[model samples]
Target: MQRAKFAVTLFATVMAIGLTGCGEEKKPEAPKPEAAASTPPPAATVEIKIGTVGPLTGSIAHLGKDNENGVVLAIEQANAAKITIDGKPAHFTLISEDDQADPKVGTTVAQKLVDDKVAGVVGHLNSGVTIPASAIYHQAGIPMITGSATNPQLTEQGFDNIFRVVGRDDQQGPAIASYLAATEKPKVVAVIDDSTAYGEGLADQVAKTLKSEGVKVLAREKGTDKTTDWKAVLTKIKGEKPNAVFFGGMDATGGPLMKQARELGIKAVFAFGDGACTDKMHELAGEAAEGLLCSQAGIPPQAASKAFLEAYKAKFNTDPILYAPFTYDAANLLIQAMKEANSADPKKYLPFLQKIDYSGATGKIEFDAKGDRKDAEITIFVMKNGKVEPIAVVKSGKTIPFDEFMKSMGGA
Candidate 1:
């Protein structure tokens, strides 16, 4: 009887195991997706080209290099942020060409950018190069925004495609003239230029303004830009014995001129336009750079926006100068326009840029009817203890008051 009971229990356990296996087999599997839904979507890719032309190797190469570094930083930051344009992920591709600060070379590079189908250009730092390069860009229907090129003639031609983020030489020349007349009150001042368009034009404008302001113009002269020695010109300036000397060229000439002027004992509160605003001036002029003055666009370096100062220091391991903020803003303005227009095509973006009021790392950027920024500010720099120091900013409180500033300089 015990054997029979054991057999029954074993049979029941076998039946339970078979029933559990059948229950597991009855469960359904998940369905396979359709072929159309199974394939992965296309990879996201969008490219926008930004071109730059500057003196990568020559006199004033440092300034060009700084400008390029600032722009590159802007591009890198934009990419890391995953900037999008018109709902599409955007990537910035920078193509820089060394124009060597030559007008012909600038024109060649501008044409090359046109052939390469870039959306816009960011440079041609020297006014001498920017003046000629602008013509080609205008013809090619590509817009160019310059940060350092301060020649007023760039926008004076009324090219719809041209714009400047910094103050012009016209504004700078008059500001220096007024400062010399009102602040220092120099009785007699001599003017000199390196004969480049920027140099000559700036000198001439200052002479005219100073003459109008009842200040005596002792002498006006031109200097060679390529020469390392400026003793001959310094001798001429020394012979004049003016109360002050105004140089219209860049630091490449201004430095040597200051050094030679000191050797000749021609110190009379020397001042120049933004061209002379460089640490190299101190190196070139030595002790003569003390109290040297220059007028540039934007606030003092110490007062620069926190973001700009920190990024510049981190990238370059030093302080930034006048043009860095302007370059950063110029690129930001372009990106803003691209976003507003919802297209990278210039034809689509130009109109939007005209009406866009962009607040950038530099300041508030709003263009007028003439393609000129409306509220641009010009800041002056003074050298002290072999360092460039910010002095003051000539802003009209709220807006730049373009018509008024131009009228003050007889440029409107």
Candidate 2:
């Protein structure tokens, strides 16, 4: 009886242990929290470098700085907008180099920009500098658009990468010459040049146009770009006593030339090309600048888009001196082409740039087969009341008064 009772007890204990094990196995796991939905990581940001080259420290440094400021404003606006390319956020950087308006220095700085791996370039304000520096950019397959360089030779080189937002010297020359012939009706006109590529090339065009118009053109006069003392040259020109004189040089030299001409009693109607068309001329020549005539390769800064002018003034605390509007357009051209291509690579975006019809601060901008701005306008300005005021605009072979042109531009 005792052995049987012990067996029952052992059996009952084993059964209890088995039941406990089954209960543990059947127990439900604590409810798991729901998983959060998966999300993809944000796209990486990209850095794009755009270069601007110009005379940042010399006689025309003001103009160069203006060009640089244009690019800076464009880049800043693009960043503020949080632009994207190929699904990646794009950040633009401006790489500015000072060419000092010197061709040799221009080439050197151009190579430096190439080595810096800039996607594109915006200048080298002087044609003399732009032409040589262009070869460097072409060799590296980089695109360069000049905001102010207007020498025909720049576009005549047949480099697909070369472009300018301003009218060529050839175009500007004829426009100003025609206006001079019509307004002044001078019997004899004297042509003078600063002997740089831009100055000499423009003077040649002027002389050619004047000859075509049956105006008596005296022999071309020459001086270095640095020639501030014009007493000797003016003495020679004064002896000729031409009824009208055209000076193809920057305001720096042209201002002094005009001031000295007035002092020397040379009472000729002084006309200048885009180089000397600036408010600075008045400052440089003082009261002598009044009544002087000048031509600009593009519309005056006052004619730029209200947005651009306001932005420029807000940033720079002054109006654009010259070429800033074009440089601003040039920089936007690059950025727009990059966006269209979805890539910042020059090789990828260049074709878009070649065919782009960009409506920018200046106006509608389009490049022809030769990479020159199509239907570029040449503006005539007169120094009145201590300011350079646009008097007329020459566009598509038609000269329109400044007021009418402004109306046509929707009063921009």
TM per model? 0.68, 0.73
Candidate 2, residues 1-412, lDDT tens digits: the string is 9999999999999999999988676432211110011112333767688999999998889999999999999988887777889888787877889999999999999999999899999998998899999999999999999998987899898899999999987798889998899888999999999999788888998899889989999988899999988999889989988999999989999999999999999999999997899899999989988999989888877778878988999998999987899999999999999999999999999999999989999889999999999999999999998898899998876788998887666554
Where does candidate 2 have its weakest 10-residue lDDT segment?
A: 30-39
Computed on alpha carbons, the lDDT of every model, listed in order, comes to 0.77, 0.89
lDDT of 2 at 281: 92
Q: How far is candidate 1 from the true structure (C-alpha RMSD, Å)?
A: 18.2
- Per-residue lDDT tens digits of candidate 1, residues 1-412? 9999999999999999999988666422111121122223324545688887788889878888877877877876776777767776777777788898988888888899998788988887988899889999999888898988876778989899888887766777777777677668888888989988878888987898789989889667887787678888778777777888888999988998888888888868888887788888999879988899887865544454567777889988987754776777777777789888988899999998888887766667888776777756776678989987666566642323334433333321
Clashing pairs in 2: none
